[model samples]
Target: MKPRKQTRTISRIMVPTDFSPGSAEAFEYAIALAKRLKADLILAHVIEPFPYNLVEGMAFSDYGDRLTPPVQRLLDHQSKRAIKEKIPVKTRLIEGAPFREIIKMAKRERADLIVMGTHGRTGIDHLLAGSVAEKVVRLSPCPVLTVRSVPAASKPGSGKARSKSKGRKANVLKDKATLI
Candidate 1:
Protein backbone atom coordinates (compact mmCIF):
# COMPACT_ATOMS: atom_id res chain seq x y z
CA MET A 1 0.00 0.00 0.00
CA LYS A 2 1.25 3.48 -0.85
CA PRO A 3 1.59 5.92 2.00
CA ARG A 4 -0.65 8.94 1.79
CA LYS A 5 1.23 11.81 0.26
CA GLN A 6 1.82 14.80 2.49
CA THR A 7 0.34 18.13 1.57
CA ARG A 8 0.53 21.61 3.09
CA THR A 9 -0.46 22.12 6.69
CA ILE A 10 -2.53 25.17 7.36
CA SER A 11 -1.19 27.67 9.88
CA ARG A 12 -3.45 30.66 9.52
CA ILE A 13 -6.83 30.99 7.83
CA MET A 14 -8.40 34.25 6.70
CA VAL A 15 -12.16 34.51 6.27
CA PRO A 16 -13.75 37.60 4.77
CA THR A 17 -17.43 37.66 5.51
CA ASP A 18 -20.32 39.84 4.37
CA PHE A 19 -22.54 38.37 7.13
CA SER A 20 -24.71 36.50 4.66
CA PRO A 21 -25.88 32.98 5.33
CA GLY A 22 -23.24 31.72 2.94
CA SER A 23 -20.61 33.56 4.89
CA ALA A 24 -22.01 32.09 8.08
CA GLU A 25 -21.68 28.61 6.64
CA ALA A 26 -18.14 29.34 5.60
CA PHE A 27 -17.39 30.45 9.15
CA GLU A 28 -18.63 27.15 10.50
CA TYR A 29 -16.35 25.26 8.14
CA ALA A 30 -13.38 27.43 8.93
CA ILE A 31 -13.88 27.07 12.65
CA ALA A 32 -13.97 23.31 12.36
CA LEU A 33 -10.90 23.27 10.17
CA ALA A 34 -9.03 25.62 12.47
CA LYS A 35 -9.86 23.47 15.45
CA ARG A 36 -8.59 20.35 13.74
CA LEU A 37 -5.46 21.96 12.35
CA LYS A 38 -4.70 24.15 15.35
CA ALA A 39 -4.56 27.09 13.00
CA ASP A 40 -5.28 30.71 13.74
CA LEU A 41 -8.22 32.41 12.06
CA ILE A 42 -8.62 35.99 10.99
CA LEU A 43 -12.06 37.39 10.31
CA ALA A 44 -12.27 40.46 8.11
CA HIS A 45 -15.06 42.59 6.81
CA VAL A 46 -14.89 45.37 4.22
CA ILE A 47 -17.06 48.44 3.98
CA GLU A 48 -17.33 48.80 0.24
CA PRO A 49 -16.91 52.33 -1.06
CA PHE A 50 -20.31 53.61 -2.05
CA PRO A 51 -20.97 52.29 -5.53
CA TYR A 52 -19.80 54.70 -8.24
CA ASN A 53 -18.25 56.95 -5.58
CA LEU A 54 -21.63 58.52 -6.05
CA VAL A 55 -21.78 59.49 -2.44
CA GLU A 56 -24.20 62.17 -3.66
CA GLY A 57 -23.09 64.49 -0.83
CA MET A 58 -22.74 61.87 1.86
CA ALA A 59 -19.84 62.63 4.17
CA PHE A 60 -17.19 59.92 4.62
CA SER A 61 -17.99 59.74 8.33
CA ASP A 62 -21.70 59.50 7.63
CA TYR A 63 -21.07 56.80 5.07
CA GLY A 64 -18.99 54.94 7.58
CA ASP A 65 -21.67 55.28 10.20
CA ARG A 66 -24.23 53.89 7.78
CA LEU A 67 -22.04 51.00 6.67
CA THR A 68 -20.16 49.90 9.77
CA PRO A 69 -22.74 48.78 12.31
CA PRO A 70 -23.87 45.66 10.53
CA VAL A 71 -20.35 44.63 9.65
CA GLN A 72 -19.24 45.29 13.17
CA ARG A 73 -22.06 43.24 14.59
CA LEU A 74 -21.23 40.27 12.41
CA LEU A 75 -17.50 40.50 13.02
CA ASP A 76 -17.98 40.78 16.75
CA HIS A 77 -20.33 37.83 16.85
CA GLN A 78 -17.96 35.63 14.89
CA SER A 79 -14.99 36.74 16.92
CA LYS A 80 -16.78 35.76 20.08
CA ARG A 81 -17.55 32.38 18.65
CA ALA A 82 -13.93 31.77 17.76
CA ILE A 83 -12.85 32.81 21.21
CA LYS A 84 -15.43 30.60 22.86
CA GLU A 85 -14.21 27.69 20.82
CA LYS A 86 -10.62 28.42 21.76
CA ILE A 87 -9.54 29.14 18.20
CA PRO A 88 -6.93 31.87 18.05
CA VAL A 89 -8.66 34.67 16.19
CA LYS A 90 -8.11 38.18 14.95
CA THR A 91 -10.43 40.63 13.25
CA ARG A 92 -9.99 43.47 10.76
CA LEU A 93 -12.25 46.12 9.33
CA ILE A 94 -11.43 48.07 6.21
CA GLU A 95 -13.18 50.25 3.67
CA GLY A 96 -12.71 49.21 0.05
CA ALA A 97 -13.82 46.71 -2.57
CA PRO A 98 -14.58 43.34 -1.04
CA PHE A 99 -12.34 41.14 -3.14
CA ARG A 100 -9.37 43.46 -3.00
CA GLU A 101 -9.69 43.88 0.74
CA ILE A 102 -10.05 40.16 1.29
CA ILE A 103 -6.95 39.41 -0.73
CA LYS A 104 -5.08 42.14 1.07
CA MET A 105 -6.02 40.71 4.44
CA ALA A 106 -4.80 37.28 3.43
CA LYS A 107 -1.50 38.71 2.32
CA ARG A 108 -1.11 40.86 5.41
CA GLU A 109 -1.81 37.91 7.67
CA ARG A 110 0.25 35.52 5.56
CA ALA A 111 -2.68 33.18 5.64
CA ASP A 112 -2.32 29.61 4.54
CA LEU A 113 -5.96 29.36 3.43
CA ILE A 114 -9.03 31.50 2.98
CA VAL A 115 -12.57 30.31 3.60
CA MET A 116 -15.36 32.55 2.39
CA GLY A 117 -18.81 32.52 0.82
CA THR A 118 -20.00 33.16 -2.70
CA HIS A 119 -23.43 34.73 -3.01
CA GLY A 120 -23.76 33.07 -6.42
CA ARG A 121 -25.11 36.29 -7.91
CA THR A 122 -25.74 35.74 -11.60
CA GLY A 123 -27.20 37.10 -14.84
CA ILE A 124 -27.55 40.88 -14.72
CA ASP A 125 -26.27 41.09 -11.19
CA HIS A 126 -23.16 39.11 -12.00
CA LEU A 127 -22.62 41.05 -15.18
CA LEU A 128 -23.00 44.46 -13.61
CA ALA A 129 -21.38 43.83 -10.23
CA GLY A 130 -19.12 40.83 -10.76
CA SER A 131 -18.41 38.16 -8.11
CA VAL A 132 -16.14 39.04 -5.17
CA ALA A 133 -15.42 35.41 -4.35
CA GLU A 134 -14.46 34.71 -7.94
CA LYS A 135 -12.03 37.58 -7.96
CA VAL A 136 -10.56 36.45 -4.65
CA VAL A 137 -10.02 32.97 -6.01
CA ARG A 138 -8.26 34.34 -9.05
CA LEU A 139 -6.00 36.75 -7.20
CA SER A 140 -5.49 35.30 -3.73
CA PRO A 141 -1.89 34.50 -2.80
CA CYS A 142 -3.06 31.59 -0.65
CA PRO A 143 -5.48 28.81 -1.51
CA VAL A 144 -9.12 29.92 -1.44
CA LEU A 145 -12.17 28.02 -0.27
CA THR A 146 -15.45 29.41 -1.54
CA VAL A 147 -18.67 28.22 0.09
CA ARG A 148 -22.00 28.81 -1.61
CA SER A 149 -24.89 29.56 0.69
CA VAL A 150 -27.44 26.82 0.99
CA PRO A 151 -31.00 27.38 -0.11
CA ALA A 152 -33.42 28.96 2.32
CA ALA A 153 -35.03 25.58 2.84
CA SER A 154 -31.82 24.16 4.26
CA LYS A 155 -30.61 27.33 5.87
CA PRO A 156 -30.22 27.60 9.61
CA GLY A 157 -33.43 28.43 11.48
CA SER A 158 -35.38 27.69 8.31
CA GLY A 159 -37.31 24.71 9.54
CA LYS A 160 -36.74 25.35 13.19
CA ALA A 161 -38.92 27.30 15.60
CA ARG A 162 -36.32 30.02 15.31
CA SER A 163 -33.51 30.37 12.87
CA LYS A 164 -29.94 30.31 14.07
CA SER A 165 -29.54 33.86 15.14
CA LYS A 166 -26.26 35.67 15.49
CA GLY A 167 -28.00 36.67 18.73
CA ARG A 168 -27.76 40.45 19.10
CA LYS A 169 -25.68 40.52 15.99
CA ALA A 170 -28.66 39.42 13.95
CA ASN A 171 -30.25 42.80 14.53
CA VAL A 172 -29.46 44.09 11.04
CA LEU A 173 -31.41 43.19 7.93
CA LYS A 174 -30.04 41.31 4.98
CA ASP A 175 -29.38 42.78 1.46
CA LYS A 176 -26.38 44.77 2.66
CA ALA A 177 -26.36 43.04 6.01
CA THR A 178 -22.96 43.77 7.49
CA LEU A 179 -19.59 45.24 6.50
CA ILE A 180 -16.67 47.02 7.99
Candidate 2:
Protein backbone atom coordinates (compact mmCIF):
# COMPACT_ATOMS: atom_id res chain seq x y z
CA MET A 1 0.00 0.00 0.00
CA LYS A 2 1.22 3.52 -0.82
CA PRO A 3 1.73 5.91 2.07
CA ARG A 4 -0.37 9.08 2.09
CA LYS A 5 2.01 11.82 1.15
CA GLN A 6 1.96 14.92 3.31
CA THR A 7 1.57 18.38 1.83
CA ARG A 8 4.18 21.08 1.84
CA THR A 9 4.59 23.39 4.84
CA ILE A 10 2.52 26.44 3.98
CA SER A 11 4.57 29.62 4.06
CA ARG A 12 2.42 31.94 1.96
CA ILE A 13 -1.30 31.99 1.22
CA MET A 14 -2.63 33.81 -1.87
CA VAL A 15 -6.17 35.12 -1.71
CA PRO A 16 -7.75 36.54 -4.87
CA THR A 17 -10.50 39.01 -4.04
CA ASP A 18 -13.11 40.63 -6.26
CA PHE A 19 -14.44 42.75 -3.38
CA SER A 20 -17.73 40.86 -3.32
CA PRO A 21 -19.31 39.60 -0.09
CA GLY A 22 -18.30 36.04 -0.98
CA SER A 23 -14.69 37.10 -1.52
CA ALA A 24 -14.81 38.93 1.78
CA GLU A 25 -15.96 35.73 3.40
CA ALA A 26 -13.17 33.92 1.59
CA PHE A 27 -10.78 36.50 2.96
CA GLU A 28 -11.99 35.70 6.43
CA TYR A 29 -11.28 32.04 5.75
CA ALA A 30 -7.85 32.81 4.34
CA ILE A 31 -6.99 35.08 7.24
CA ALA A 32 -8.04 32.43 9.70
CA LEU A 33 -6.01 29.81 7.90
CA ALA A 34 -2.98 32.04 7.66
CA LYS A 35 -3.22 32.85 11.32
CA ARG A 36 -3.37 29.19 12.20
CA LEU A 37 -0.61 28.14 9.83
CA LYS A 38 1.66 31.06 10.71
CA ALA A 39 1.87 31.93 7.04
CA ASP A 40 1.95 35.27 5.23
CA LEU A 41 -1.31 36.29 3.55
CA ILE A 42 -1.39 37.98 0.15
CA LEU A 43 -4.51 39.83 -0.96
CA ALA A 44 -4.63 39.91 -4.77
CA HIS A 45 -7.07 41.82 -6.95
CA VAL A 46 -6.83 41.80 -10.75
CA ILE A 47 -7.81 44.88 -12.71
CA GLU A 48 -8.97 43.32 -15.93
CA PRO A 49 -8.75 45.78 -18.80
CA PHE A 50 -11.76 47.18 -20.57
CA PRO A 51 -13.02 45.20 -23.52
CA TYR A 52 -13.18 47.04 -26.89
CA ASN A 53 -10.29 49.11 -25.62
CA LEU A 54 -10.77 52.49 -27.28
CA VAL A 55 -13.44 54.97 -28.31
CA GLU A 56 -13.20 56.31 -31.88
CA GLY A 57 -13.02 59.99 -30.85
CA MET A 58 -11.95 59.58 -27.24
CA ALA A 59 -8.55 58.00 -28.14
CA PHE A 60 -8.58 56.55 -24.61
CA SER A 61 -11.12 55.46 -22.02
CA ASP A 62 -12.09 56.21 -18.46
CA TYR A 63 -13.48 52.72 -17.90
CA GLY A 64 -10.53 51.41 -16.00
CA ASP A 65 -9.83 54.82 -14.45
CA ARG A 66 -13.13 54.76 -12.60
CA LEU A 67 -12.75 51.13 -11.58
CA THR A 68 -9.26 50.86 -10.11
CA PRO A 69 -9.46 53.11 -7.06
CA PRO A 70 -12.44 51.52 -5.38
CA VAL A 71 -11.00 48.04 -5.77
CA GLN A 72 -7.65 49.24 -4.46
CA ARG A 73 -9.45 50.72 -1.48
CA LEU A 74 -11.02 47.37 -0.74
CA LEU A 75 -7.65 45.65 -0.95
CA ASP A 76 -6.07 48.27 1.30
CA HIS A 77 -8.82 47.94 3.85
CA GLN A 78 -8.41 44.18 4.07
CA SER A 79 -4.64 44.41 4.21
CA LYS A 80 -4.76 47.03 6.94
CA ARG A 81 -7.02 44.90 9.10
CA ALA A 82 -4.77 41.89 8.78
CA ILE A 83 -1.65 43.91 9.58
CA LYS A 84 -3.33 45.39 12.63
CA GLU A 85 -3.87 41.90 13.89
CA LYS A 86 -0.09 41.41 13.62
CA ILE A 87 -0.34 39.19 10.59
CA PRO A 88 2.27 39.52 7.86
CA VAL A 89 0.18 40.71 4.96
CA LYS A 90 0.97 41.79 1.41
CA THR A 91 -1.34 43.01 -1.36
CA ARG A 92 -0.99 42.99 -5.15
CA LEU A 93 -3.28 44.73 -7.60
CA ILE A 94 -2.39 43.82 -11.15
CA GLU A 95 -3.84 44.91 -14.47
CA GLY A 96 -4.78 41.85 -16.56
CA ALA A 97 -7.31 39.08 -16.83
CA PRO A 98 -8.26 38.05 -13.29
CA PHE A 99 -7.65 34.34 -13.69
CA ARG A 100 -4.37 34.66 -15.54
CA GLU A 101 -3.07 37.29 -13.19
CA ILE A 102 -3.99 35.24 -10.18
CA ILE A 103 -2.34 32.08 -11.48
CA LYS A 104 0.80 33.93 -12.49
CA MET A 105 0.99 35.67 -9.15
CA ALA A 106 0.62 32.40 -7.32
CA LYS A 107 3.46 30.90 -9.27
CA ARG A 108 5.70 33.93 -8.93
CA GLU A 109 5.05 34.19 -5.22
CA ARG A 110 5.31 30.44 -4.77
CA ALA A 111 2.12 30.46 -2.76
CA ASP A 112 1.53 27.32 -0.78
CA LEU A 113 -2.22 27.82 -0.82
CA ILE A 114 -4.65 29.74 -3.01
CA VAL A 115 -7.84 30.74 -1.24
CA MET A 116 -10.54 32.32 -3.41
CA GLY A 117 -14.25 33.12 -3.61
CA THR A 118 -16.57 31.06 -5.77
CA HIS A 119 -19.18 33.14 -7.65
CA GLY A 120 -18.50 36.77 -8.47
CA ARG A 121 -19.84 39.41 -10.83
CA THR A 122 -18.75 39.17 -14.44
CA GLY A 123 -16.59 41.79 -16.13
CA ILE A 124 -15.99 43.71 -19.39
CA ASP A 125 -18.73 42.39 -21.63
CA HIS A 126 -18.86 39.26 -19.57
CA LEU A 127 -15.70 37.99 -21.20
CA LEU A 128 -15.33 34.24 -21.64
CA ALA A 129 -12.91 34.40 -18.73
CA GLY A 130 -15.83 33.85 -16.46
CA SER A 131 -15.63 33.15 -12.75
CA VAL A 132 -12.03 33.91 -11.84
CA ALA A 133 -12.27 31.42 -8.99
CA GLU A 134 -13.07 28.57 -11.31
CA LYS A 135 -10.21 29.38 -13.64
CA VAL A 136 -7.71 29.69 -10.82
CA VAL A 137 -8.71 26.33 -9.48
CA ARG A 138 -8.19 24.81 -12.91
CA LEU A 139 -4.76 26.39 -13.31
CA SER A 140 -3.22 27.01 -9.92
CA PRO A 141 0.17 25.48 -9.09
CA CYS A 142 -0.73 24.80 -5.47
CA PRO A 143 -3.66 23.66 -3.42
CA VAL A 144 -6.84 25.72 -3.75
CA LEU A 145 -9.22 26.13 -0.85
CA THR A 146 -12.58 27.53 -1.91
CA VAL A 147 -15.04 28.86 0.64
CA ARG A 148 -18.29 27.60 -0.80
CA SER A 149 -21.50 29.56 -1.00
CA VAL A 150 -23.71 29.45 2.05
CA PRO A 151 -27.32 28.48 1.55
CA ALA A 152 -29.75 31.35 1.96
CA ALA A 153 -31.58 29.58 4.78
CA SER A 154 -28.55 28.51 6.77
CA LYS A 155 -27.68 31.26 9.20
CA PRO A 156 -24.67 30.77 11.46
CA GLY A 157 -26.47 29.14 14.36
CA SER A 158 -29.37 27.40 12.66
CA GLY A 159 -30.23 24.06 14.20
CA LYS A 160 -30.34 22.28 10.82
CA ALA A 161 -26.85 23.43 9.93
CA ARG A 162 -25.42 23.09 13.42
CA SER A 163 -26.31 19.44 13.50
CA LYS A 164 -24.94 18.51 10.07
CA SER A 165 -21.74 20.55 10.28
CA LYS A 166 -20.57 18.86 13.47
CA GLY A 167 -18.82 22.10 14.43
CA ARG A 168 -17.29 22.44 10.95
CA LYS A 169 -17.32 25.93 9.49
CA ALA A 170 -20.73 27.24 8.58
CA ASN A 171 -19.59 28.00 5.05
CA VAL A 172 -19.56 24.94 2.77
CA LEU A 173 -16.35 23.75 1.13
CA LYS A 174 -16.48 23.46 -2.67
CA ASP A 175 -13.05 22.06 -3.09
CA LYS A 176 -11.83 22.33 -6.70
CA ALA A 177 -9.20 19.62 -7.34
CA THR A 178 -7.90 20.46 -10.80
CA LEU A 179 -4.12 20.77 -11.01
CA ILE A 180 -2.98 22.38 -14.19
Candidate 3:
Protein backbone atom coordinates (compact mmCIF):
# COMPACT_ATOMS: atom_id res chain seq x y z
CA MET A 1 0.00 0.00 0.00
CA LYS A 2 1.24 3.53 -0.80
CA PRO A 3 1.84 5.95 2.09
CA ARG A 4 -0.70 8.71 2.56
CA LYS A 5 0.36 12.20 1.45
CA GLN A 6 -0.54 15.25 3.54
CA THR A 7 -1.35 18.60 2.03
CA ARG A 8 -0.98 21.92 3.82
CA THR A 9 -3.85 24.38 3.78
CA ILE A 10 -3.70 28.13 4.36
CA SER A 11 -6.70 28.44 6.69
CA ARG A 12 -5.96 31.84 8.22
CA ILE A 13 -4.05 35.02 7.38
CA MET A 14 -2.95 37.77 9.82
CA VAL A 15 -2.75 41.38 8.70
CA PRO A 16 -1.31 44.07 11.00
CA THR A 17 -1.95 47.70 10.23
CA ASP A 18 -0.72 51.06 11.51
CA PHE A 19 -3.48 52.80 9.52
CA SER A 20 -1.05 54.46 7.10
CA PRO A 21 -1.72 54.62 3.34
CA GLY A 22 0.70 51.75 2.83
CA SER A 23 -1.10 49.71 5.47
CA ALA A 24 -4.44 50.49 3.89
CA GLU A 25 -3.12 49.18 0.58
CA ALA A 26 -2.00 46.01 2.32
CA PHE A 27 -5.44 45.63 3.92
CA GLU A 28 -7.09 45.80 0.53
CA TYR A 29 -4.69 43.22 -0.88
CA ALA A 30 -5.24 40.93 2.11
CA ILE A 31 -9.02 41.11 1.66
CA ALA A 32 -8.74 40.12 -1.99
CA LEU A 33 -6.35 37.28 -1.22
CA ALA A 34 -8.52 36.03 1.63
CA LYS A 35 -11.55 35.90 -0.63
CA ARG A 36 -9.65 34.00 -3.32
CA LEU A 37 -8.04 31.52 -0.91
CA LYS A 38 -11.20 31.05 1.20
CA ALA A 39 -9.11 31.84 4.28
CA ASP A 40 -10.10 33.63 7.46
CA LEU A 41 -8.51 37.09 7.75
CA ILE A 42 -7.52 38.77 10.96
CA LEU A 43 -7.31 42.55 10.88
CA ALA A 44 -5.37 43.80 13.90
CA HIS A 45 -4.15 47.05 15.37
CA VAL A 46 -2.02 47.60 18.46
CA ILE A 47 -2.58 50.54 20.76
CA GLU A 48 0.50 51.10 22.88
CA PRO A 49 -0.51 51.73 26.48
CA PHE A 50 -0.29 55.26 27.88
CA PRO A 51 2.99 56.14 29.54
CA TYR A 52 3.28 55.06 33.16
CA ASN A 53 3.49 58.61 34.51
CA LEU A 54 0.39 59.62 32.55
CA VAL A 55 -1.57 56.75 34.04
CA GLU A 56 -0.15 57.33 37.54
CA GLY A 57 -1.14 61.02 37.61
CA MET A 58 -4.81 60.31 36.90
CA ALA A 59 -7.18 60.20 39.86
CA PHE A 60 -9.53 57.21 40.33
CA SER A 61 -12.54 59.36 39.40
CA ASP A 62 -10.80 60.68 36.27
CA TYR A 63 -9.72 57.17 35.35
CA GLY A 64 -13.26 55.89 35.54
CA ASP A 65 -14.60 58.89 33.65
CA ARG A 66 -11.96 59.04 30.92
CA LEU A 67 -10.92 55.48 30.30
CA THR A 68 -12.09 51.85 29.92
CA PRO A 69 -15.52 51.41 28.32
CA PRO A 70 -15.32 54.22 25.78
CA VAL A 71 -11.96 53.10 24.40
CA GLN A 72 -13.15 49.50 24.22
CA ARG A 73 -16.30 50.61 22.43
CA LEU A 74 -14.34 52.67 19.93
CA LEU A 75 -11.99 49.81 19.14
CA ASP A 76 -14.95 47.49 18.77
CA HIS A 77 -16.69 49.90 16.39
CA GLN A 78 -13.57 50.39 14.25
CA SER A 79 -12.99 46.67 14.02
CA LYS A 80 -16.61 46.03 13.08
CA ARG A 81 -16.58 48.75 10.44
CA ALA A 82 -13.36 47.43 8.92
CA ILE A 83 -14.77 43.94 8.75
CA LYS A 84 -18.27 44.84 7.58
CA GLU A 85 -19.39 43.34 4.20
CA LYS A 86 -15.87 41.96 3.74
CA ILE A 87 -14.60 38.38 3.64
CA PRO A 88 -14.74 36.34 6.86
CA VAL A 89 -12.63 38.42 9.23
CA LYS A 90 -11.77 38.52 12.90
CA THR A 91 -10.58 41.82 14.31
CA ARG A 92 -8.37 42.39 17.34
CA LEU A 93 -6.99 45.38 19.23
CA ILE A 94 -4.02 44.56 21.41
CA GLU A 95 -1.62 46.56 23.61
CA GLY A 96 2.12 46.31 22.97
CA ALA A 97 4.76 46.94 20.30
CA PRO A 98 3.15 46.50 16.88
CA PHE A 99 5.42 43.68 15.70
CA ARG A 100 5.25 41.85 19.01
CA GLU A 101 1.49 42.10 19.14
CA ILE A 102 1.21 40.88 15.56
CA ILE A 103 3.36 37.82 16.16
CA LYS A 104 1.58 37.06 19.42
CA MET A 105 -1.82 37.29 17.77
CA ALA A 106 -0.67 35.14 14.84
CA LYS A 107 0.47 32.45 17.25
CA ARG A 108 -2.71 32.64 19.29
CA GLU A 109 -4.82 32.31 16.16
CA ARG A 110 -2.51 29.74 14.53
CA ALA A 111 -2.35 31.82 11.36
CA ASP A 112 -0.69 30.33 8.29
CA LEU A 113 0.69 33.59 6.92
CA ILE A 114 1.13 37.30 7.74
CA VAL A 115 0.78 40.21 5.29
CA MET A 116 2.01 43.74 6.11
CA GLY A 117 3.36 46.98 4.58
CA THR A 118 6.75 48.69 4.60
CA HIS A 119 7.29 52.45 4.70
CA GLY A 120 10.08 52.20 2.05
CA ARG A 121 12.41 54.58 3.83
CA THR A 122 16.00 55.14 2.71
CA GLY A 123 19.35 56.76 3.71
CA ILE A 124 19.18 58.21 7.25
CA ASP A 125 15.48 57.46 7.50
CA HIS A 126 16.04 53.78 6.81
CA LEU A 127 19.15 53.55 8.98
CA LEU A 128 17.79 55.48 11.98
CA ALA A 129 14.33 53.94 11.81
CA GLY A 130 14.06 50.24 10.98
CA SER A 131 10.85 48.65 9.74
CA VAL A 132 8.37 46.53 11.68
CA ALA A 133 7.78 44.43 8.56
CA GLU A 134 11.50 43.65 8.39
CA LYS A 135 11.55 42.58 12.01
CA VAL A 136 8.37 40.56 11.66
CA VAL A 137 9.75 38.80 8.60
CA ARG A 138 12.82 37.76 10.53
CA LEU A 139 10.96 36.62 13.64
CA SER A 140 7.52 35.44 12.64
CA PRO A 141 6.72 31.71 12.87
CA CYS A 142 4.70 32.07 9.64
CA PRO A 143 5.72 33.39 6.23
CA VAL A 144 5.55 37.19 5.90
CA LEU A 145 4.47 39.05 2.77
CA THR A 146 5.69 42.66 2.75
CA VAL A 147 4.00 45.01 0.31
CA ARG A 148 5.54 48.25 -0.97
CA SER A 149 3.36 51.07 -2.22
CA VAL A 150 4.14 52.02 -5.79
CA PRO A 151 5.42 55.54 -6.26
CA ALA A 152 2.97 57.82 -8.06
CA ALA A 153 5.34 58.53 -10.96
CA SER A 154 6.08 54.84 -11.46
CA LYS A 155 2.47 54.03 -12.34
CA PRO A 156 2.68 53.75 -16.16
CA GLY A 157 4.37 56.93 -17.49
CA SER A 158 4.82 60.21 -15.62
CA GLY A 159 7.25 61.61 -18.26
CA LYS A 160 9.92 63.63 -16.34
CA ALA A 161 10.12 61.17 -13.46
CA ARG A 162 13.13 58.89 -13.91
CA SER A 163 12.73 55.29 -12.90
CA LYS A 164 15.11 54.04 -10.20
CA SER A 165 14.65 50.64 -11.74
CA LYS A 166 18.26 49.48 -11.45
CA GLY A 167 19.90 50.76 -8.27
CA ARG A 168 19.79 49.24 -4.81
CA LYS A 169 16.65 50.30 -2.98
CA ALA A 170 16.21 50.13 0.76
CA ASN A 171 12.95 49.40 2.64
CA VAL A 172 11.77 47.36 -0.35
CA LEU A 173 11.82 43.75 0.66
CA LYS A 174 12.44 41.57 -2.42
CA ASP A 175 11.25 43.37 -5.59
CA LYS A 176 8.26 45.28 -6.99
CA ALA A 177 7.38 42.22 -9.06
CA THR A 178 6.57 40.28 -5.86
CA LEU A 179 3.56 42.49 -5.17
CA ILE A 180 1.69 41.29 -8.26
Query: Which of the numbered candidates is closest to the native, going by highest TM-score?
Result: 1
Q: Which residue pairs in candidate 3 collide?
A: none
- Compose the digit string of candidate 2's lDDT tens values, residues 1-180: 999998789889998888876777677777767777888999999887867756564433576677778878888988986786677998898888888999899999999999877753458634764667777778889988877555546556767764774323323332422123
Tell me the spans in candidate 3 whose CA falls farther than 4 Å from its real position: 1-7, 50-86, 157-180
Model 3, position 16, has a per-residue lDDT of: 86
Give the Å shift of residue 69 in candidate 1: 5.4
lDDT-based ranking, best first? 1, 2, 3
The per-residue C-alpha lDDT of model 1 at residue 170 equals 16
Query: Model 2 clash pairs?
Result: none
Q: Each model's C-alpha lDDT? A: 0.78, 0.75, 0.68
Better of 2 and 3 by lDDT: 2
Expressed as tens digits, the lDDT of each residue in 78-177 for candidate 3 is: 4563366366777777666877888888899998888887788889998897778877888898888777867665565554333443222323324531
Task: Report the Cα lDDT for candidate 3.
Answer: 0.68
